[model samples]
Target: MYFDIAYYFRVLRHVWSLKQWPGKRGMLFRLLLVVPLVSAFHALCFLLDYVFFPRLWRQTVERPVFIIGHARSGTTLAHRLLAADGNQFSYFLYWELFFPSLLQKKLIRALGRLDALLGSPCLTRLQRWDDKTFGPTRHIHHMSLWNAEEDQFVMRAAFVTQQWALDVPMMDKIDLFHLDQMSDKKRRRWLHHYRECVKRQLLLNGGERTHLSKNPLMCGWVAALQETFPDARFVVMLRNPNECIPSTLRLLELSWKGRGWQPEQYRESLRVMTEISFESIRHPREVLAGHDQAVFVDYRKLVAEPRDTVHEVYAALGLTVSPSFDAYLRAQQDRERNHQSRFTYNIDDYAVSVDDIEGELSELFDEYQWPRLSRRSDLVKSVGP
Candidate 1:
């Protein structure tokens, strides 16, 4: 996202606050290259906003729909299903996270059109490369430049996000626990940058559609989000911690590999998992307690009964599921049935036991009567007397 020189400096200053480097010379060199490229883009965005699109800052955002939970809790799938109701949701793409300026987005679109007209395979090649890298984990989480992405990447532009910890080992310090203690002024600044990016996406979508974001990081920012968008609606996805934690660690390791950076081992992964699980359990309670518009969708229900789940989500949010949206959902479900995941796991993958996960998430599982690890098979069956 575009920001002023001052904001860029603030973010850089935070990056420099790291007292340790958790990578080799190669990762350090990559960061050197990234620094100047981002700096140039930042300056260019400043000029473009001031000279051409000053009105973007004035665009108002309405009741945005936030899809939030711990990572790998079906957030990507849920976001994909919801965004397919294109008439109702204005969304962010994976590439937009890197170039969030209005001018940059226009340039990307123009280049895409030119590539198509010239019969060039540049864009197709990139998508294929993404497929090759991400296809194996498609059942867990998927990524592409064109698909709806988590807002945490956009928040990374402000240099305050857990996503940053994946590559920049120094960023590991800013987990949910650390963020909860962030100064009020710094927290506000971070959220303001987040707002600026979301507003720009809304402007690009022509300003009428409701903005839909699938930012798992926002799970820890329920209080801040409430303060900013008092009318925003939330869809909190619920999955067993036994499954979510290891899969999340797998995703983080893959992210590091994709970026040519090194991934942290057991200790860091455990720290992230414990904190995210705690927040995943607690954040929904905070949101539902403070707002009348929040809804929780069980991951089991979503995977087993996609159609009914979507209907219930719409009803909870007081929105209608258009016929076209329903058709899209059914088609996707039919196609995926042929390729459903056989992937399974045990809590031992994360160097933790079932008792540990239960202890960490005791309140949530007990409150909801969620099935324990041994009985997770019942998730696929319909719940009835």
Candidate 2:
């Protein structure tokens, strides 16, 4: 009952103010009071952040490093492991997931100072000091830690909405692939917006040489990406569709519950997400034709031996193994000790049958060594909590 109520409210929060809710704008207008209030809060945050924190310029230079694979394929685990090298560039744990950079760039140092002054750095329990994050996520827009994270960028920028995200539309019209036919003029514009955003991140963090980012959108645009970043390396995490789909469905269900209020209302969205499940197998070989650095790391393997797997990943990405990297890796493990406690879910409702799972992920199962389960037992010991 509690889950149901919480889920409904979440959906309301997501859909209430968006395109679906009609009277929401009126509330937003009435909440103009919040603008000034938040502005003051933001400005005060700015003064504090600017004063205390070292002003960083993002080190988001185009590098051949990446942590990828299909959805739920240890990308987060891998990205977090590689992130430990202070030299390997990445957004800080707080900033990457919470993209509040526009203001942070100018005032994050001061914000920290202010927080210390208050004896409240204002860290949320939600702000895990160490957690693995995977995304081409960058800080582009706000300064509030409440900003939406990376996948939103994929959904909106890639133009892969609920309806046609997986339908294989004309290559030119597809979001990521669309870049292929973009007039040199238009393509550069998108790249510029993207690059500048990344550059801002690099500017904020100094001495970072390699830019390793991850995104599931790359599942379909292997050729175009290789061409764009000719020196770019790939690390596609392979997960069986059976496991990946149910996990993805659960995630989408959670998101929908948080934002839209009713699952029935989001039928199309649920369907879109369901089809996106098989995305990995639909275009696998194209992901890594002959790039030596292009690796397909098994999530299960990494889950079993995280440190060793991470080390292998760094070596594959051509990054040097350093004590600093190991330190960061250790710190991340400590953070994970408590992550599961914060999440609540109903797994019974999420029951994904073996047949349905196989039907969806058959391609990935046949291609990769990802385990296939006839019942949930085969996956029970499959690893990676």
Candidate 3:
């Protein structure tokens, strides 16, 4: 059934008020509409929850797994591979953002299946809920759908609570980090709920011994993750920082998008990412040293010899190599492959010498001995820029 009459009227009022606002075009539209809509949505959820079926709200966590690395670090690919075990179920698209005590959970899952068959499920430019490869999952929020760990829900909490203008710049800033000035107690509350949201996925899935997941944002929060689940294993994917820097710049560029950015934000994000990615790798290595729980994999190795690499990971995790898993691997074998992002960035694009950008990652690149494009250029020049 459609919502109550008051709900319909409220929505109409929201839409009509939206048409009147002069500042609705830019950040203003989101600032105004997102607040009340999200607020109403959240309230409607709690109101219907428990009082209704209460079962969907009470499911226990089934299994817990995680995929952790910086953005664009092949974490998405890993999510696909690990989650491919057909025996182990994952939350589908619609259940992502949808919170309906019970009516919606059953309703949404049914619709998601139908939507997948009827046509495409691509919801936002960022991702799709449909059955296509080469895409990340987002948009739909349901209790049933497994989600890559995202701050969007948490950040949405802040948005609804404070209406802290989620314009393009703020999003870029939030992308970098969100709990900048909150007190320790408040920050802990944010983190607690964040993990709770993740734990809920394990509840929705079969709650197996192994809970598989991946999130690019988790890199910065490695310590927090270790604090929460000491047994949690992290697989950090590494690429040459010189290549990583440009790829990170591109990812940020994708987010800033239409808004004009201060040249400094791009440079700063690059510089910050360079530091954080390496720190994310090193600090966890140092902290989790004796634990032997965290593993680092090379992206090139993953794409080239996926079977061997995946086998290595499974072996390390102590998973009994099942024949069913082998079939799963074959199915995923020739799937959407990696697109090496290094070639996407030309030396001329940044208006800075490769050496200059390479300088930020000097410590990491040198330690890992991944050659610089500058060094490669010199090698080419000696032989035949």
TM-score of each: 0.83, 0.64, 0.68
Candidate 1's displacement at residue 234, Å, is 0.4
- Which run of 10 residues does model 1 get worst, by summed lDDT? 376-385
C-alpha lDDT of all candidate models, in order: 0.69, 0.50, 0.50
On lDDT, the candidate that comes out on top is 1
Per-residue lDDT, model 2, residue 128, is 43
- Encode model 1's per-residue lDDT on 158-262: one tens digit a residue: 444454455554334445433335678766766677777788788887878899998777777777777778788999988876667666655565566675554
Q: Highest TM-score: which candidate? A: 1
- Residue-wise lDDT of candidate 2 within 122-162, one digit each (tens)? 65332443222322122111122433223214222222232
- Positional deviation of residue 112's Cα in model 1 after best superposition, in angstroms: 1.7
Estimate, for each residue in 5-47, the C-alpha lDDT of model 3 and write its tens digit: 3323443344344444343464445545765676577556545
Off by over 4 Å in 2: 1-60, 92-104, 117-188, 221-224, 327-353, 360-363, 376-385
TM-score of 2: 0.64
Rank order by TM-score, top first? 1, 3, 2
Residue 34 shift from truth in candidate 2, angstroms: 11
What would the TM-score be for candidate 3 when compared with the true structure? 0.68
Winner on lDDT between 1 and 2 is 1
